[model samples]
Target: MQLILASKSPRRQELLTLMGVDFKVVLKDVDESYPQNLSPAEVAVFIAEKKARAFDEKIEENAIVLTADTIVCVDGLILGKPEGEEHAFEMLSLLSGRKHEVITGVALLQNQKIHSFYEISEVYFKSLEAADIRKYIEDCKPFDKAGAYGIQEWPGLVAIERINGSYTNVVGLPTHRVYQELQKLK
Candidate 1:
């Protein structure tokens, strides 16, 4: 069966390749907005399922479609991708010397049936100096990442103290879980 990845994230694409999976990328514009009543994890799952549903009619019968969304949450608030440099700085400042949850929700659609799950990873950051934050922002330009940071980038190298769950989950895709789920289909 062919595997179709419905996302444009390079990190996710790389991870899938590392897993030795031959997949095709199918890009779609998915509306990520969710209801205010949903929790952070639920919001992530909602968006992922929404993306998968968008490709339901387009996928081949012998193909499986995978869709995912990642969100960073701290103190009950969800911090999505930053709007700009200032927003990135504010997000980094809030995460300094704190631990936050990174949740990635994944949906697999095959034969018109959708299966979904979520993975949560706890990431702890060291106390970051203003200058260091500024430099990281300038160097990384993490405007496309959640919480204004990528756990595998320069900010991650200098700021991340530890993580309590799947490291790949923080990278945008929970690889271990993904492999297991894919096995079930086979």
Candidate 2:
């Protein structure tokens, strides 16, 4: 079956390619807002399923559409993509010298059925200096990333102390889990 990826994230596209999967990127704008009562994982999964369902009427019989949403949660708060430099700085500061969870929720749409799952990875950061945070923000311009940082970028090289789970999940997609789920569908 042909695979369809419904997202605008280049990171997800790159991950699929790295996995040697032949999939086409199909973009659709869906409301990402979730019910406030939902937990972090639920919020991610809800948005992911929402994205997949947007293509429900348009998908071909032989196609499987994959959608995902990644979220950074710390101290019961969800940190979304930063709106500006100050927001990014604030997020980075909050994450410094702390453990946070990066949750990537995935949904697959096929034959009018939706299959969903999530991966949560714990990230530990070293105590960061204010200057370092500013420098990273200025250099990376991570306005498009959840958590205001990319685990594969500058911060990953120096600021991160350790991670407890899938590194790919922190980057965006959970490669191993995604591969397993796709294999099942095949």
Candidate 3:
């Protein structure tokens, strides 16, 4: 059976490729907005489902389509990708010396069947100074990632102190769960 990745994220594609999954990329443009009352996990799941809703035409009877959305939550606020350099610094500064949760929701779809699940990982960061944040921001382009940081980048190498769950979830996807889910289908 063939698999379709319903996103344009390079990280998600790389992870799926690493697992030796034979898949093709299909870009589906879907509105990411969710209900205002949903929690972070629910929000992620909602958006993921929304993205999957667009694949009704692209999916074949035997083909499986996958969609995912990642959210970074600190306290209770959802921190999406930064809009600009200043916003990136602001997000990183707030996350310094604090613990946050990374949530990723995945939706697997085929003809008349949809499976969706979410994973959460706890990440802690050490206290970071302004100059350090500045240098990291300059060295690493963080504007495209949630929480204005990538766990695989420079800040992840130095500022991250501990992680209590799947490390891959922070990079963008929960690969282990994704692998198991795929196997069940096979």
Candidate 4:
């Protein structure tokens, strides 16, 4: 079956490649907003499914389309991508010396059928100094990352104390799980 990834995130693309999947990137503008009544996990799944719906009429019988959304949740609050440098700083400050959940929701669409699942990884950050945060913001400029951080980047190398779940989930995709699901689809 032909595989189509419906996202523009480089991290997700890299993870899929590392999983040994030969796929093509198909970009679609998806509305990411969710209802206020949904839980963090629900929100992630909802957005992922929403993205997949964009290809409902376009997917071919022999093509499988994959869509995913990742979010950082702390105390039931969802932290999305940072808007600016100061926002990034604020997000890092909130995450300092705390354990937060990174949830990535994935949807596989083929021939109008959709299967959705989510993976949650717990990430713990060490106590961060203001200077260290500033340096990371200045150097990395992580405006496109959720919670203003990327688990595979410089800030993650220095700030992350430990993780309790799939490391690749924290990076954006749960590669092992994705591979398993893809095999099932085949």
Candidate number achieving the greatest lDDT relative to the actual structure: 2
Query: Which residue pairs clash within candidate 3?
Result: none
Candidate 2's TM-score reads: 0.98
Cα deviation of 146, candidate 4, in Å: 0.6
TM-score of each: 0.98, 0.98, 0.97, 0.98
lDDT of each: 0.94, 0.95, 0.90, 0.92
Candidate 3's C-alpha runs over 4 A off are none
lDDT of 4 by residue, 77-154 (tens): 899999998889899999999999999999999989999999999999999999989898898889888999998787
Residue 172 of model 2 has an lDDT of 95
What ranking of all candidate models by lDDT puts the best one first?
2, 1, 4, 3
What is the C-alpha lDDT profile of model 1 across 68-169, one tens digit per residue?
999999999999999998999999999999999999999999998999999999999999999989988898899889999998887678789899999999
- Residue range 1-186, candidate 2, lDDT tens digits: 899999889899999999999999889999899999999999999999999999998988969999999999999899999999999999999999999999999999998899999999999999999999999999999999999999989889998999999999999999999999999998
Clashes of 2: 0
- Select the stronger candidate by TM-score from 3 and 4: 4
Name the 10 consecutive residues with the lowest summed lDDT in model 3. Answer: 53-62
Query: In terms of TM-score, which candidate is stronger, 2 or 4?
Result: 2
